[model samples]
Target: MARTVRFHEIGGPEVMRLEDLETGEPGPGEVRIRVEAIGVNRAEALFRSGEYIEPVKRLPARLGAEAAGVVEAVGPGVSGFAKGQPVSSVPAFSQNDYGVYAERAIVPAAALLRRPDGVDAVSGAAVWMPYLTAYGALVEVGGMRAGDVVALNAASSGVGLAAIHTANRVGATPIAVTRTRAKRERLLEEGAAEVIVSDEEDVPVRLLALTGGRGAEYAFDAVAGPGVTDLARAVAPGGTLLLYGALSGRPTPYPGFDLGMPALNVRTYTVLETTRDPGRLRRAEAFVVSGLRAGVFRAVVDRLFPLEDVVGAHRHMESGARFGKIVVTVTG
Candidate 1:
């Protein structure tokens, strides 16, 4: 029997339940993995509450997007992967359904990536969503280049931290924005060229000061709403402002005149758009894996909870108290 977390209704964290499920053999081009660690993402929370654009289709839905595990069985048509091999999978909504949060999951072979020698299960599980999102935004969409100045908000979150690391790796200067003064030092230690506390300091003023009044070449904003105006003010002329997430639960407000005056490119970006091309997905996976192998990218795991404690994990994530990725450990 496989143990899994499932939810029957759309509600708060309390709605989740742990249940016993049966596992079956993989079909052609599929592989069965004994899950070790699962990443807890904000998307899962939104999905549970039925707030995301894509609605949950049925009751008793399994909630998870990514996980790391060891292969237990490989289907007949699958090659190059053997049973007992360590692997990580990107189980997006369109690919696999209702299985990643379980003790074992059957996923398509194309979704699996070999876990590099130096990477552990916990880190491997944490790396997929945030790194891929960051890579797609910064390198692919924003066109961040050497010597460019990049500003990132929510700089302590998993995606924000990944952006900082990616910026540094590409020789771009990263300016991190956070709401807490306590996270400043740590943000800088994590490769941010400078840290801006949005509550204490005037973000646009500090950004202008840092860039010698020229402003940043690109701004990656996770917090939407009026905060986007501040990001717009800090963008250099002709720079791109890539709006990725709405952490503030409000729509990004753009001043009508500002868009025309500076000729700035303001666009909403999502990982799905950038990674839609097969080549881009391959390049993104290769880039992130290479960074992990070379030690340039480090997965910051704040805490781990048992699979049954998922409600607590979701609450912790909602509180925004964690500095890095929160994970759920599944044991057989």
Candidate 2:
């Protein structure tokens, strides 16, 4: 029997319960994994709280998206993966729900990616979602190119860090925006060409100055609402504003005239849209794996908690004290 975390109802972290269940062998084109680490993302919180666009099915839904483990069993028709091979997967939403928080999980072969040699389970689990989102937004959707100036809001987040690293890899200058002044030096060290303390500095003014009065060529905004308007203002002529997240829990108001008149493109993207396309997913995974293997990108784990203490982990993530990814270590 596999031990898994299940939630009977949508509400606070207290609603989550740990239970024991029998896990069957992987079906065709699937693989069973002995889960080591599971990533805790904001999407999980939204799903648990019933705030996400997609509705959670019935009671006792398992919760999680990405995980890292060693392959325990490879189902029929699965090739190239051996027993005990280290792997990571972003399971399909339906199966992903209760499985990733369990001691063992079954996932499709297509979702499976081998972990890089030196990457640990925790870091490996952290890599897929954020980096994939970053890659899709910046390169695939935004069409970021060399010498482009990119501005990323919530620049201390996992996705933000991924954006900075992606921009660096593409030979673009990444300007990171953060509300906290303390994270400036760390952002710089992480490949941000410049860091803007949004709460302290005039964002539009500083952005214009940084771009030599031209403004950033691309803006990645996670914090929506009034801040998005400012972000649109800082976009250079013919620039793109990719709004991927709404951390503020409010509606984003945009000045349609400003965007339309100057031919500024305002695009909203979700990881699902990008990953749903097999070819895009393949490209994203390949690039991310290569970056991990080459040490061009590193997963930042703020803290790890036992699966039993998931409530505490969720609270910590909600507290906004964490600067990077938070993970849960699932024990067998």
What is residue 80's positional error in candidate 2, in angstroms?
A: 3.4
Q: Write the per-residue lDDT of candidate 2 for residues 201-279, one digit (tens) a residue.
A: 9998999999999989999988888778777888998899898888989988875574566758888888876666788
Error of 2 at 296 (Å): 1.7
Model 1 lDDT-worst window of ten: 90-99
* Residue 229 lDDT in candidate 1: 77
262, model 1: CA deviation in Å?
2.4
**TM-score to true structure, per model:** 0.94, 0.94
Q: By summed lDDT, which 10 consecutive residues of candidate 2 come out lowest? A: 90-99
Give the clash total for candidate 2: 3
- How does each model score on lDDT? 0.85, 0.86
| Model 1 alpha-carbon miss at residue 253, Å | 3.0
Candidate 1, after superposition: displacement of residue 231 in Å? Answer: 1.1
